[model samples]
Target: MTQTSNISRRRRTKQAKGGADYEAKRAELLRIAAELFKEQGFQSTRLLDIAQAAGLDRATVYYYVGSKEELFHETVEGVLDANIAVAQQLIEDDSLRAIERLKKIFVSLMISYEDNYPATFVYIQEQMHQVAADETAWAQDIMKKTRQFDQILIGFIGDAIAQGDLRGDIPVRLVENALFGMLNWTHRWFVPGKGMTGQQVAESFWSIFIGGMVPARADA
Candidate 1:
């Protein structure tokens, strides 16, 4: 079965057993797991470590979070799904001009990364660039959703070019990849609650990159 189905089953099972308290504890465990994964790479982190950090025995940790992979999924998948959902909503919002939509997408995404705080960065560092084989259901699912997100950005850029909001000379995919590179590279240095907020970062990037993408003035 798919990762979604598997997760659903786990949720149902958890609910059947422990209801709201179970979910609350599981959420806390996932929080601890994300912090561990961020500090130490996934390969080095163990289920036992997460269990210990959560004040639970190994056996009970299994009852709450299952495996390390499941814990990883619990940490990452919600962020991915949320970003994708917001991007889709922005793309469908015809009320805004294409440039406005794209700007909102960039800003919103950066804020999301901030809000998620290291989960998105962990995913970028660990799995964003990997070729998703038929290895695991969650991996495949993440890859698929990631591509959909990419396409949405590309499509929006293409629309901007067609609408004369952006320069038509550059290839759409090139612009898309460049935008992603600019945003994704933040994983290397962006520290939450430090200098420049996510919106500031996004606005700075937009000014630098989108400035180049827009058509030059006739006076110039």
Candidate 2:
């Protein structure tokens, strides 16, 4: 290889390693920001609070994740991106019945909520009114991702209704909203018991409510 070719290869390797280091630091900052946001709320939590939580100076925190609003936006983005990926998987899987896929999504969402409560807390608890008031480009993307989930959810409900799993009489929008309302409200009051797990709680929701929604068979 030419001398310049060897130089280029080393440069690329260094860049890749640098990128990985950047992401790791950014992720750590995001975690600290999420918890502070959940505990004190978006408006109350400032850059200094996040910097202190992450054990860094205010300027160092910005170097890692940007402004407080931008940091919060990225936090919400991570959770929504994960949830969307799971929903996409269930939507594409042909093995599971439509109703079954729907139930799996519920369980996955609950599991996500348990593991990433701070991120979930941001999505469930914070209103984007402040973000919108700021009018930054990052804030603009927030609504798009949120609406994207709503659209995908509507698709799932429509598929279930089409397969005769959900009642056709109910409006699609209402069904979608109702499912989200059930899941989002749980974060506020639902507590897991000693013997029970988040997955079990999710299953219980499916077992109880889905049982009522799905049509009954004549067979005993």
By TM-score, who's the top model here? Answer: 1
TM-score of each: 0.88, 0.79
1-220: candidate 1 lDDT, tens digit per residue:
5765666676668868887888899888878887888899877999999999988898677667668878778667888788888887887787988778888888888999998877677778985656365467778888888789888888888888888999988898898888767888898999889999999999999999976777988999
Ten residues in sequence with the least summed lDDT for candidate 1: 127-136
Clashes of each: 0, 0
Cα error of candidate 1 at position 29, Å: 1.3
- lDDT at 158, model 2: 86
Give the best candidate by lDDT: 1
Reference-based lDDT, each prediction = 0.82, 0.74
* Model 1 TM-score, all chains together: 0.88
Per-residue lDDT of candidate 2, residues 1-220 (tens digit): 5754555565455546778777787788788877888788878988899888778887555455547777766667777789889988887888977777778888888888877766676766776456556566766776677688778778777888899898777788987667766777886775545456778878887777776677555594
